[model samples]
Target: MATLLHIDSSVFPGETSSSRSVTDAFRKAWGEQHPEGRVIYRDLAADPVPHITATAHLAGLAPASERTPEQSAALAARVELIEELEQADAVLIGAPMYNYSIPSTLKTWLDNVILAGRTSGETPSAQGTPVVVVASRGGSYAPGTPREGFEFVQNYLEAVLKGSLGLEPEFIVPELTMAPRVPAMSELVPLYHASRERAFVEAATKAKDLAERLAV
Candidate 1:
């Protein structure tokens, strides 16, 4: 059976987190479509990955056989993470915008998985592995908005995962997530709920389609 790696980076729990709720929908659809398929879940907010340190950075660059004990220990967790990604047939990520960028916990996981030789280096291409990202933002960042260019989450992820890592990713974004809760955004509540609904629907559809297509 095919395997999927599900990663959630939201700090909030339950329905309070748009990204998590959307990803949960995706997971539900995926499970229904591929009941026998394997799923590996990692909750970065609850259990954050270690940030890449200078030593770990150097360790990843060197040949595994040549690393020292310290380097080997430092690189172990990262190696495991990369192995999980490489082994999976597909990936799903719950990515929420924080301070105009991805969560630091998610960033740390990316740093761990974007390894040379293991994930991207010398591979034919990474595009064959599909990735679905459920991205949610507190405010709207679409074109023509005041914060149009300020949004960096999607662009940065695309650049790293697709441009650099060669993986093909599809993004489902829910904007104005804070509208329902923030008095300043009360006028945008309708749009917020609409966006939220669309995100879950899109995620479920994509998950089912991908599972069917990728399942062996």
Candidate 2:
């Protein structure tokens, strides 16, 4: 059975996050398809990933084969992130856009997951992990939309997931411009619920396609 890791980084669980709704849909379908599969979940919004401190970076930068005790320990935590990834055949990441980019917590978790000589080496062929990134926003960012400037999150994530990590990370974005849902804060609750429903449907379809391809 395939191992699936569902990583969600959304600040709003009660109100419903666009990204969170999608990721959960993906996980549910994936589980149904692979009934015997092992699944693990990490909610960064609830228990955030640690920020990479300067000291941690200093330690992490040391040669993997020559890490000192402290360096080894620091890098060890990062290794756990990668091991979880490596052991899994598929990964599902859900993150809401923050200031037109991925949340800092998600970014921090990625810093730990995409390590050298594991997710990728100095060489490109060595990198073959596949990732699925689901993003949500309060606005639209379709190719020709006026809010296309908000695409920085998708662009940055694709670059880092593929370029830095040397892996292919497919992006599934469901944009729900708030205008339709709410005229003002008073309508936000209703809009939030509507967005979640839409997000779940879209994500279920996208996830099935991705899971089938990856599982094969």
Candidate 3:
């Protein structure tokens, strides 16, 4: 059976969070296809990982046997985080845009797992793993949109997951998430629903495809 590492960084837990909802759909479809598969879930909003501190930085630089107690603990956590990714056949991330970027919690998780020799060495690879990102944005940031240049979530994640970690990824983005909730965006409600529907379809399709491709 394959193992999927599912990470959700949405502060909103359920249907309110578009990214979370889309990832749930993906997992639902993936689960149907791989009933015996294992899912390693990490809900960053409920149990947030710590950001890299000076001690943790030193731990990564120091030799394993020569590390201080705090450094050792910090390094051990990093090791566990990296191992989770290393063992996974595929990875799924729910990253909702916050202030035109990914949440701080997601950033913290990235900081924890991005080790020098492990995730980003000269021969770096997320063990040749594949990742699916359900990225939800509150407003439109497409090619001709006024906020196009300000969009950073998908671009930054692609850089880190592909460029830094050497992992292949497919993204499903649902834009204008807040249109239905904001009175000013009333006219965008149709677009919002359409984007959301498309995201779910893409998520399910990609999840099943990745699951089959990565199955052991």
Candidate 4:
């Protein structure tokens, strides 16, 4: 059976979070397609993984036989995360833009899983795995927009997930997510709704498409 590693980092819960909502739609579609598939879920906001520490960093670099007790303990957590990524057939991430970038919890998760010569480098263990990222944002950041250059969530993730980890990444972005809540951005509320609707459709379509590909 196929295994999907699904990670959500939004501070908000349920439909309150644009990223989570879109990811939830994709996951629902995926579950429908893969009734017997396995899903490994992680809610980073509720139980954040440990940030990389000196011992953890060094432990990853050092040979297992050379690691001290402290290093072993710290590295064990990282190894578990890496193993999950390596074993997964697909990956799904809810990466809401936080101050023009990804959440710290998501960054920490990346740090834990991206081990050189293992999950990363010239030949990564999980290389070519398809990853769908829901990169939702509070405001518009598409080309020609004022904040176009400020969009780091997708750009950074593209480099990290595809460039570093060698995963195949495709993004479904829901922009102007704060339009309904922010008084000044009320005019963009319609646009937000359209973007959100499009994202949901894309998520379901992509989920089914990926499931079909995986099954083949």
Q: Which segments of model 3 are wrong by more than 4 Å? A: none
Of candidates 2 and 1, the better by lDDT:
1
Alpha-carbon shift of residue 118 in model 2 (angstroms) = 3.0
lDDT of 4 by residue, 131-152 (tens): 9999999999999999899999
Query: What is the number of backbone collisions in each predicted candidate, taken in the order shown?
Result: 0, 0, 0, 0
- For 49-157, candidate 1 gives per-residue lDDT tens digits of 9999988888989987999999999899788888788788899999999999999999999887787766666672344689999889999999899999998999999
Backbone clashes in model 3, listed as residue pairs: none
Tens-place lDDT per residue, model 2, 66-129, is: 7677777777777777778777677788867888888888899987776555565686432666
Candidate 3 local lDDT, 1-216, one digit each (tens)? 888999999999798889889999999999998899999999999999888899987898898789999999988888888889988989999998999899999999999888888789787747478999988999998889999999898899999998889898888989999898899999999999999999988988998788767764
Candidate whose lDDT is highest: 4
Which residue pairs overlap in candidate 2's backbone?
none
Better candidate by lDDT, 2 or 4: 4
Instruction: Supply candidate 1's per-residue lDDT for 83.
Output: 78
What TM-score do all the candidates reach, one by one? Answer: 0.95, 0.83, 0.97, 0.99
lDDT of 2 at 194: 69
- Between candidates 1 and 3, name the one with more favorable lDDT: 3
Give stretches of model 2 more than 4 Å off.
64-66, 123-126, 184-199
